[model samples]
Target: MPRMLDVSNDVRAEIGDEEADRLLAGDNAPGAYDCTSCRTPGNTEQELTSTVLFVGQETAVLAFAHATCVPSQVVPVSEDQLRGAVRSITGEDTAPSYAPPVPAAAHAAAPHFPAPAAPPAYPAPAPSPASPATASHTSAPSSHAPVPQQAVLGVTSGVVLVGREACPALVVEPTAPIVRPGSPGHGDEFLQLLSEQGFAPVVDLSRPPAPNPGWSVLLAMGRLHAVLMPAPGGGRPVAWWQAHSPMPLSEGWRGAVGRTRKVLIYAAAAGTIGTQPREDQLRAALDRAAARGALVGASMPLAGT
Candidate 1:
C-alpha cells in the first residue's frame, strides 16, 4: 500500500533516493506514528506525513511528523538525546550495551570529531554567564514602534539545529515592558512589532525560520556586534539592536558561522525569555516561548564589521 509520505529534497539528499523510496513504499515507514512536532498520533496512509531525521554525532534516528505541522528535514542533536528519542519512538531502549573493545589497530581507523592531528574545535559547550558578553541598545524597524521602559536589550548567543546543520542563533529580549512609542500603560508588543518587519511565529523548531531579507546579524572579528535592518529612509543599514560592546564568539559558534555564514535571530517580548546559563536551557526557554506564541524569528544572512 502507498503511504502519504512527504520526503523533502533536503531529507532525500541526506537519506539517499534508495532509502527514501523504501520509506515511500511503506517498506520502512510506519503506518501510525506519533508526530514528532505535535506529539499526536497520525496515520501515514491517511494524511501526509513528514519524515524527520535526527542525526547525532554517531547515531541517526528517523521519526515521523505531520506534514502540516512541519516539513520533512534533518535535525542535529546530541548523541544521548538521539538515543533517548529512539527509545521513546520504538518503545525499546537504545542505549549501547557492553561490547568487546575494538583492537587498537581498528581504533586508528575510527572516525571522530577531529581528524588525525586536527585542532579541537568545540563551542557551545562552555556555558558561561559571566563571560565578556554585551548588553546592547537596539532599534525596532516597525511602523508601530514600542516605547521601551527599561529598553535595554539583551542578546544571548547559542547554536540551534536548522535542517542538517548547527547554525548560529541569537535570542533578543528586552529587560522590561515595551509598549507603543506613546502608550499610556505598560504592555508588551515586541512580537507584534517584529511581525510587521517580517519575523514569523515559530510553530515548529524542526524547520528553519522564514527568511528575513534586508536584515542581518553582524559580527566583527568573530565578535557579535549588532543586528542590522534596512534603514527607515534608505541610506545605510540601521541597528535593530546594536551591541554597545561587542561580545566575543566561541570557537564553535564562530566556526559554525564560517561554514554556514548565516544566523537565525529570535525575539520575544520582555520577560518572555530570560538569560539562560546554558544552551540547552536557552533552547528550552525558546521552546516554551514558541509554544505560547511569544516567539518570532527570521533567518538572516551574516553581516560584519
Candidate 2:
C-alpha cells in the first residue's frame, strides 16, 4: 500500500495539480510543496489519490486523499498563483507566487534618501589661451562651446560624492562592513535589485589588476563598453574609458560612469536626484557626453541620442 500524507494549504499552493497527480501516482516519493499555510511533503505511508474538479473556467477544486487518512479542508488560490505553481512544477522560469514580508527592523535601519535637485545654469565658456602674435594668424571657430566640467568622486577606502557638487550617495565604511558578496543579506539585496533593473550581472573571475574588475556595461546607446580600473604605477590616478562604438553617451550614460557614477545615476534616475543638477538634466548632460564620444572603451554602433 502507498503512503498517505497530509498537506496544508501552503503546500498545496506550491505543488500544483500536475505534481500532486504525479505524487499520488507515485512519481515523486520524497517531495515538498509550498502554499500560504506552510510547506508539505509526501513521505507518509498509505494509498494516495488526487482529483481536480472545476468550479468554472477560472476556478477549480483540487482534492487529495489517503486511503486510510482523512483529508483536510480545501483552500482557494488565485489563478495567477496557480499558474506560477504550474510553471514551478514544469521547471520553467516564473516569478514566485509569494514573497516573504519585509521586516520592520530593516525599514528602520536605513532611512530612504530624497531625490536630487536641479543643476546650476550653464556657465560661460572660458577664454582660450592666447597664441603668440608672431605665430600664424588663423581664425578659430566661434561655434565650438566649452564642455561643462563634471566632477566625479572616486571611492576606494570609502565613498566619495561625484558631480559638480557633493551629495549623499552610498554608505561604505571600510572599518565596519556588515555583509560582503555571497552573504545571505548581500545576495538577497543584489538579486532583488538585479531583478528590478532587468539586468543579469556576470561575475568576473579575473585578477584584481584587470580593468574595472572585468566589469562591462551594456549601454542603452546600442554599444558595449568596459569599465577600466585606476591605473597601476600611477601618478594622479584616473579611470580609463574605451568605447565599443561611437554611440552617444546620452543614450546610455549609465554604462559610461564608474561605480560611483552608476550608483548616483541610478539614485537620481529612480526619482532620487538630490538638490543639485536635476535628474532629468543630469541625464541630458550624460547624453551630450555620449554624443561627443566621451564614453571610454566603447566601439559599438550609435543609436538615438
TM-score of candidate 2 on Cα atoms, chains taken together: 0.18
**Candidate 1 versus the native: TM-score?**
0.52
For residues 157-190, write the lDDT of model 2, one tens digit per residue: 1112234433211111111111222244421131
Q: Rate the local accuracy (lDDT) of all candidates.
A: 0.61, 0.25
Task: Show the lowest summed lDDT stretch of 10 residues, model 1.
Answer: 115-124
Candidate 1 Cα lDDT to native: 0.61
Candidate 2 regions off by >4 Å? Answer: 5-37, 46-71, 93-305
RMSD of every prediction: 17.0, 23.5
For candidate 2, the per-residue lDDT at 231 reads 32
Q: Total clashes, candidate 1? A: 2
Tell how far residue 108 is off in model 1, in angstroms: 57
Q: Which stretches of candidate 1 lie over 4 Å from their true place?
A: 1-128, 131-148
How well does candidate 1 score on lDDT at residue 243?
Answer: 44
The model with the greatest lDDT is 1
